[model samples]
Target: MAQGPPPPSTPVELLTNKGIIEEPFVNKFWGPALFGTFTFIGVCVSNWFTRRPVFAGIQKHIILSGTAAVIGKFVDDYRAGYLAERDAVLRHYIELHPADFPPFERKKFADVLEPWVPIR
Candidate 1:
């Protein structure tokens, strides 16, 4: 009996079927904020051990943490906005030139496209 075509094989089949993993929201903001807070606390403790005023530097720690949080938020927002813009552009292009994309794949991109908003 003739067997059908051999099943596909990979040189390293162990790596196949791996799925994408997303990062947690905490890593984007709280992680950086905590790191900054701890670093500033260490500095304050060091100053206290050296007979320097520790309270004077408390505001600095708060500012550093806030800054880190703000920066993290900005980075996250920018990334999301960038991806939205990219999808919008791609959808527009696909709509304008339907023949360029395969029919089977067009349905996957059928979601309503987001309007492009220029960054101020």
Candidate 2:
């Protein structure tokens, strides 16, 4: 005898895949799918608006994108509490290795980011 495959990522995903969490609906499957689908639709809508008046719809897209990012972030944070935990671990690591990470200098900002910017 042998195993077939690995397990699912999250508890909700696992339950939904196995047909265990079948009641009214499958929250795990629908939640991310709907969120991503709507987010992409929102971008398309913004693009549609943008085509009408050159750069007029740009600001709308920016705001909408920002809103989507914030909402998605909030959902992930609420679900996993990753931010605080990662911050705590990072803080501890920094404390343990103060010499490895140097303090930021305002003068070096341009030097740090200039290469990434396009030439033209």
Candidate 3:
């Protein structure tokens, strides 16, 4: 049987339909959003202090935008490094202990990681 389109619904349903509700909030924020926000704020403060009087406005905007771009690229590279390193470790451990390691898509987990992981 052919299924009809979903009916108009409440706010939650609307959000779900738009994919906002279904999207993982933490995952979304971790990758680029959080990094970008931190970079923007950091650049703004630094530029505010260091910028010359006449060119301060233009410099501030340029600095913030540039910081975000540079930081975002750094974050991407950092994440790729972490993924490669983590996967290597996991593979090594699994090779040492076959019984403990279950076969699965290790790359999937690696791909979902953020640039910064606290080592403690």
Better model by lDDT, 1 or 2? 1
- When 1 and 3 are scored with TM-score, the better candidate is 1
| Model 3 lDDT, residue 43, Cα | 65
Candidate 2 runs further than 4 Å off: 1-40, 46-56, 81-120
- The C-alpha TM-scores of every prediction are 0.43, 0.29, 0.39
Instruction: Tell me model 2's lDDT, rounded to 2 decimals.
Output: 0.57
Q: Note the residue pairs that clash in candidate 1.
A: none
List the candidate numbers ranked by TM-score, top first: 1, 3, 2
User: What does the lDDT come to for candidate 1?
Assistant: 0.62
Report how far residue 9 has shifted in candidate 3, in Å: 40
Find the candidate with the highest lDDT and give its number.
1
- Per-residue CA lDDT of candidate 1, range 1-120, in tens? 966443324322222223434557776666556656776777688778989888667777678767766766677678777976776676667667766654332223447577689999
Per-residue alpha-carbon lDDT of candidate 2 for residues 63-100, written as tens digits (9 for 90 to 100): 76567656765685576557556656776676677687
Q: Which residue ranges in model 1 land beyond 4 Å of their true spot?
A: 1-56, 105-120
**lDDT of model 3 at residue 92?**
66
Alpha-carbon local distance difference test for all models = 0.62, 0.57, 0.59
Worst 10 residues of 2 by lDDT: 8-17
Better of 2 and 3 by TM-score: 3
